[model samples]
Target: MTNPRQPHQPRQLSLNAFLHDTGHHEASWRHPESSAERAHDIEFYVEQAQKAEAAKLDGVFFADIPGLWAATPYRPTAHLEPITRLSAMAARTEKIGLIATASTTFHEPYNLARLFSSLDIISGGRAGWNIVTTQSEAVARNFSLATMPDPAERYARAQEFIDVVTKLWDSWEDDAVLADRDSGRYFDPDKVHAINHVGRFFQVEGALAAPRSPQGRPVYVQAGSSNEGRAFAARNAEAIFTAHQTLGDAQAFYDDIKSRAARFGRDPGHVKILPGISPFLGDTEQEAKELQQYFNELTVPAYGIGQLESLAGISLGHLELDERVPVELFAGSGDVLDNNRSRLQVVANIVERDRPTLRQLLHRLAGGRGHNVVAGTPLQVADIITEWFENGAADGFNVMPPLYPQLLDAFTAGVVPILQERGLFRTEYAGSTLRDHYGLPRPDSLYAATAAATTA
Candidate 1:
């Protein structure tokens, strides 16, 4: 079968190593492959970043949370702040993009704009902002709110938040910084205009504190699958981080989101939908399955019950381990219970299909709940990625390693070379910035366009 897109000629797949504390699974630190002792150490993260850069991967991403999860013996609860760590990482690595998550729900637009702009400047343009509206109730208390806002309200505020932030980034014209010591003028006041943004959620009447970022703005990345989330991403996200358990699910999401992009007058091709993939690799298929089993066996059932409580919104302690979850438990939920619909759906599907005991379900989700988890040899793993990318089920992937550095090392060393040999991945980065790395066009400064038009 001849494919029209085949002329695209195995477009080099984008890969980002999603660096979690030790690994993506909550119980990974308990595994022998992970180093729990160094989870808090900055050097550990820096080394991971360096490894990704050395492998010539596109970027390294750090997911963040503003509040702690319910105390669990199985999971490490502590984490270093992502932006500060990435700032330190910027100094050590030269090429790989540094992406960090920041929630719009808890932060002011002006401040976030300055933070990411500064990161872009420091990293010489390789910066990405993974925009998220936090789904944690615990986070609300930290921000002096009684409870988390509704998802619809959060998305509304997020839209305005992004609009205001982009305006602030655009406030300082590209040529605003003169740096002409001879004239004793550091900037052109006329060029540095105030955003004067007034919106339903916030009001800021000034320009951003920093100069223009190297890429004009940090690459706008988003990771949400709700309808509101999809709309927001279609309008603003350059890259999307998504999670799905099956090939059918991933393809459905891929088609839906890309179809929505066109309604916003965006080139569907411009919004890269990268599903999260957690691969467990070994010399042979049996060894890989054994490795996966090892991690699942290491999982603590109590912790899994706690996590399942969050997803199902029903305490599982009363239910027998071997009993099937009742469908009635999910009926007519309010926002608190339904905040994570995607995750809830995954749980429902698992319960319906596998009919697994409580103990078994916990093990199934140990490696990253509902995201595609594959246990195979390097060739087998590569085949999955190739099939997904070639079949339009994914543009690429946000690689979630089941264990840190070792799992990452295996993918970069084993799977990456196969991809390169097959011309499905790049041997060297095509450009420097995150935008360039993703083949996205740099947006022209709104200020620049107005000025040139006025002069003519």
Candidate 2:
């Protein structure tokens, strides 16, 4: 632990704990090791955040959907709004980044920007927004809409949304607040300016009510993998959270995103591409497989079928559980780079390569819903991380444990030490802000630049 690593290294791996209710496994709620009954408790989340911070992870992320999950009938489907819980977490922990999902389709830029700005200020610069275009019609209904917009229209609106929000965030300059008791002038009027944004999807005007946050602006993170999604990320996302099932697929995605970012006149290194990894660990390889099988056996067939049907846009009524799934079912998704249905393409690759039975496919998807799932010892998991990092397959990983506190604890305790010893990951955090943790600099304020130009 003392000398295996050098004093200085060019790049260190970034890791985030992708926290779900009980765990990432569809049947994890049924496992005895899980805290299934306490899903709604704020303390439950606080504990997880503390654990991740203790291990010096880059951050903790929460994926949100306004409506119930498709497999809600089989698991605990309720959730506390991520921002509310994270605000509480901000006060409890220091240094770890706080990221939460919010759909551009459902939120107006003004209110969303204000919300994140406040969180950034409150967290002392450790806030991130995982931008998403909610794809579910069910979720749209919650907002009193009849149907969700098509992907093209949604992405178009999101492009404008990002523009408006960032401008609003920069409405107040970095040194706007004066807080002078002697003069009684709280802020310099000259430092604040109206955004006055007008676009196809929105019209937001005036400066933000919240003062400039510590990071200047919150980090922009994107999770979509569609063609439009990639283009959006290339143009705007500072960090990207994605999923893949193989080294080849992951490597291709890594290269394509970096190249696309460069074409947009953006620094490719500024876009950190972190793929989701769900590993079930044990002391030995056989034990790991057995542990994974334990969770797989707990999955309800109906629930797994519903999840598959949703992702693949196909029905499985005709096929028996043990029968082979036809490769032709996913013929349209052959091009991984351009496929709008990002997750279905992962399943297609799985069926084409391994030729699994319907049941086996279900088991595979259950572990992480098309994210890479590995059942191995801590050493094996470390090898996977190292291989992907060294080979340009990933910048880092989104560690998703199969069960709460237990699996997460296992990862931080077992796998983290290995990563630290090899100098692939940081043994301790060196900075206070989320941007600092991700190796990103605070972005220059747009309004500030405009003011300086006007003065000149």
Per-model lDDT: 0.85, 0.89
What are the C-alpha RMSDs, in order, of all predicted structures?
A: 3.6, 3.2
Clashes of each: 0, 0
> Poorest 10 consecutive residues of model 2 by lDDT?
1-10
Question: In model 2, which residue pairs have backbone atoms overlapping below 3 Å?
Answer: none
Off by over 4 Å in 1: 1-10, 326-339, 453-456
lDDT of 2: 0.89
Model 2 bad stretches (over 4 Å): 1-8, 335-340
Best by lDDT: 2
User: Counting only residues 3 or more apart in sequence or on different chains, how many pairs clash (N, Cα, C under 3 Å) in candidate 2?
Assistant: 0
What tens-digit string does per-residue lDDT give for candidate 2 at 1-456?
A: 011223365678999999998999999999986898889988899999999999999999999988786635788887889887889999999999999999999999999998999999999999999999888878888899999888889989999999999999989998889999999999999889888887788887879998989898888999989888999999999999999998998999999999999999987888999999999999999999999999999999888888788767788989999999999988888553432477888898899999999999999999898899999999999999999999999999999999998999999999999999998888878788888888887877897888779999
Q: How close is candidate 1 to the true structure, as a TM-score?
A: 0.94
| lDDT by residue (tens digit), candidate 1, 22-98 | 89776788876578999899899999999998888888999887987566656888788889999999999999999
